[model samples]
Target chain A: MFLIIVEKSNEVIYIKITKIAKAGTLESNDILIMVMPNDSGNIELELESIVMQQFGDVIEQVILHKVKEMGIEGITIKAQDKGALDYTIGARVETAIKRAI
Target chain B: MQKLRRTMLFMPGNNPGMLQDAAILGADAIILDLEDAVSLTEKDSARILVRDAIKYIDYSQVEVVVRVNPLDTEFGPQDVDVIARVKPDTLLVPKADVEEIKLVDIMLAKIEEEEGYLVGSIKIIALIETALGLETVYEVIKASQRMVGVLLGGEDLTADLGITRTKEGEEIFYARNKVATVCRALRVDAIDTPFTDTNDYEGLTKDTARAKSLGLTGKSAINPRQIEIIHAVFAPTEVELKQALRVLAAMEEAEKEGKGVFSLDGKMIDAPVINRARTTVELGQRLGLIER
Candidate 1:
């Protein structure tokens, strides 16, 4: 969000997600994120946003970056964005991850 | 010198649109509310959201305030803990009292030391809303070294008093006087509560003017439209500014002539008048109503 991006390292830390966690809302300028455990050893993200055409890639990157920052892997993230900035995106992801763990 | 805080606008903490636009609004300070403005279920998410907004957003040239829940509530501790890490300009403690303020101050001190932030870098503003807090308001303001302001929560204070809050505001008159006088004595900002009716600009101006006359430094605005009206009421009038300038000029002349008292337009001017004029000039300069 601050233009400081870390390399997505190969070392992936996996934690057992015992329950589904969700954060944020569909309000304008907000992004709702839901996290669940996935059996596949890969990170999957399902994204839908009002501004998908303009900022979908950046929003996905922010979510992945935050997930990567938390060293989370083998998890599925679903984000519903309504033009949320990178900070909001990052925060929503962090909150969802915190709840999931 | 005291800062100009004539209009402290209240913005919902969880709304990213409002948070992003807060700085561009003309209020002297913007209060990001995590208390009554937020729902119980959304507390966790709102705290994280507000922290990130403060961390990433550029709120330049305007003071940033965050109103956390009361410590007795479950969310209050986490709110303070998470929000303090971002180091907002000030924390408005609602349902405030001496004991609560002391606890908040202690918590802030520990965080400041642990995080290597300057001890007392984060200021505190007490929201005195209950009868007991009003009775012991002086002690509350003195409880913390970080105390910089006190806001009168009229809605809650009137509810505690078992009285209806009318547009006339006669019910909170005593509370207003007490809070303002104590804040003045302690050299802190005395902020009046928001005038909830957003449609009536005339009523808003009158309410702000009354609060200003009662010695309040500022008034809280529920709507952005109330900001300029509150600021206008607080700014010194053209006649008042002209008279202040004349009194100041005469005071300077008196000082050169080795006298403590002077006269302007056949009227006696003394220490109190001189001090008042100086305060007006300083306030005028702060409001950008006159050239420094």
Candidate 2:
């Protein structure tokens, strides 16, 4: 799945995800997200999960919502889902962003 | 009311998985760590996470404590700033002395004023981790009206004393003894530092026994597995519970008979004995070892 959202940002993006940071666990009903900096100034998402064939779009929407909520750009989010809820995904994204900053 | 604090488990503030389940882990208190548990680079984000956790988390039966950085650090003011807005059950001031505690007290007062919370609603737990802090612990305990307890910081004290840290904990003996004594003198709870060896359950048990013998009300736990042992070690024993019940019954009878003193099994039971019994019963009730 792919997503593209346009928002005005004139400030220079100097701070990036300096390291490979991760959140959540590989446990049942959990999702592990690996977030890193992207050079293309676009939010790139790569998802892998058994449920992706069914709930791929919904999961992408959740990740996109959190990325936009944090005002985060130029980031790559790789989410490995195992039936995690929206709250869990949002929390993981927030933690990854905090670690990146 | 002074709630039970037999086991205060430390959950890393930045770890949402831990924070989300902290209250349900059967600890009497949960300390969200924004200090040593979190790295320097992630301090700001950790504080923000902890602030949101306190606001949103349903910590109904558990007391929530935030261990903020020392006031001397750049993060101290920001930690307090977040705390003022969230208003946790208590603030665990790390590496604290009289001056530092007073500073926190003053800032809490100002924040309470600005935030429109009740003045002195947020309690303070002074963590004595330095030579100076241990030396002046008496003043530190009395520095603020909101003071609830004092905790010994074993690792920091060992580092400050230039001694090797050990599971045996001989190096922190004097500091632990002094903190317990001062806390007793001030009628405050004395909380011991965590036993760092999470893998060694035997060592943790022995350490907790030592802390109980020293008259410390509680000990901090770095892991959830340690909580049950801490609570078990601190629970009122069966014999003590029976004695407390008898003493309370006798006291009530004496009061009804207009008597100030009484004899139980040929031993005198007076104000001090009754007070001790009351404490035992209260502790038992709080631990759920006895009927309320």
Candidate 3:
């Protein structure tokens, strides 16, 4: 039964999960990212940051860039930022997505 | 190419504050740690952070060493990939043995070729943390032409020996001595492990003194507070510096007289003595203890 399911190419294409996968810490200069599967093929990002007023768009772009780099789509990311750098944000999202998959 | 490695301070790779200020901490080398310092889930982030840190930070004269994950782990290859591109001064390989050191050397060569980096420019610091690593220390040190130093990992080595860790460092005495001996024999730097008790200034001083007594070139520092003590312990004292200068003067006079051996303060100054005096003078100059 498992082999038949794996053999069907279309059956494995949409294997997405609704479970929330989290990565990173709430420590200063760190960000926590939670990722979950979404069916609409749209990336919904909810960012809460201390520097949201100034760096919001840049942070969003970084997260999106990382997600695209991983070729991920149809996922919702909840990024709780505590003034994290671009590298930290990307790492958290990458780890969250890996855990989700 | 022996460099000043008196104090190699380790900072967690993910901590931006630490990374930003690493250069100003006055350590001889700044080690951005991507292994034990980072949690499992944060490994990717730490690597990325370290990669960017290496690119942007002005380490000035302080050498930058990145402690990458063990080659057997999932993050190791990724860590090396970034490290190769970033090109830190050295890579510290934890739990390193002969084969692992050789493997990383090969991997680094390949990465250097691919990235157009100078082959063997990035050096290797084999962190001997396992019993097997300890047993194969000679082979591990000899495995790579890029090998610049060997660091003893006390905590893991103690665990491997099933012995208790202590502040006095009695448990790691044998391992430290062995590493120092091997390093001296192979003409590479021997770096002692960090003193875990960050707040015990007296103990830290004593531990560093013990390392110096064992003829270790340097010791790792977990905190900035320890850097001064390590440096002080390793620096040539004024009396020693004076003696070294006198020896040099005596040797120069002997050379003028076409003599191979001479005496200073009623003691024979032969090759070994002259060599020691030269090392003392060089170290004093390097540490800014002696006017160049």
Model number with the top lDDT: 1
Sort every candidate by TM-score, greatest first.
1, 3, 2
Off by over 4 Å in 1: A1-12
Candidate 2 lDDT for residue B132: 95
TM-score of chain A of 2: 0.82
| Candidate 2 local Cα displacement, residue A97, angstroms | 6.5
- When just chain B is superposed on the true chain B, each candidate scores a TM-score of 0.98, 0.93, 0.97
lDDT of each: 0.89, 0.85, 0.86
Query: What stretches of model 2 exceed 4 Å from their correct place?
Result: A6-101, B253-259
| RMSD (Å) per prediction | 3.2, 4.2, 6.3
TM-score of each model, paired residue for residue: 0.95, 0.81, 0.87
DockQ of each: 0.72, 0.17, 0.28
Give native contacts recovered, as a fraction, per prediction. Answer: 0.81, 0.00, 0.37
Better of 2 and 3 by TM-score: 3
By DockQ, who's the top model here? 1
* Residue-level lDDT tens digits of model 3 in B220-278: 99999999999999998999999999999999999999999888889999999989999
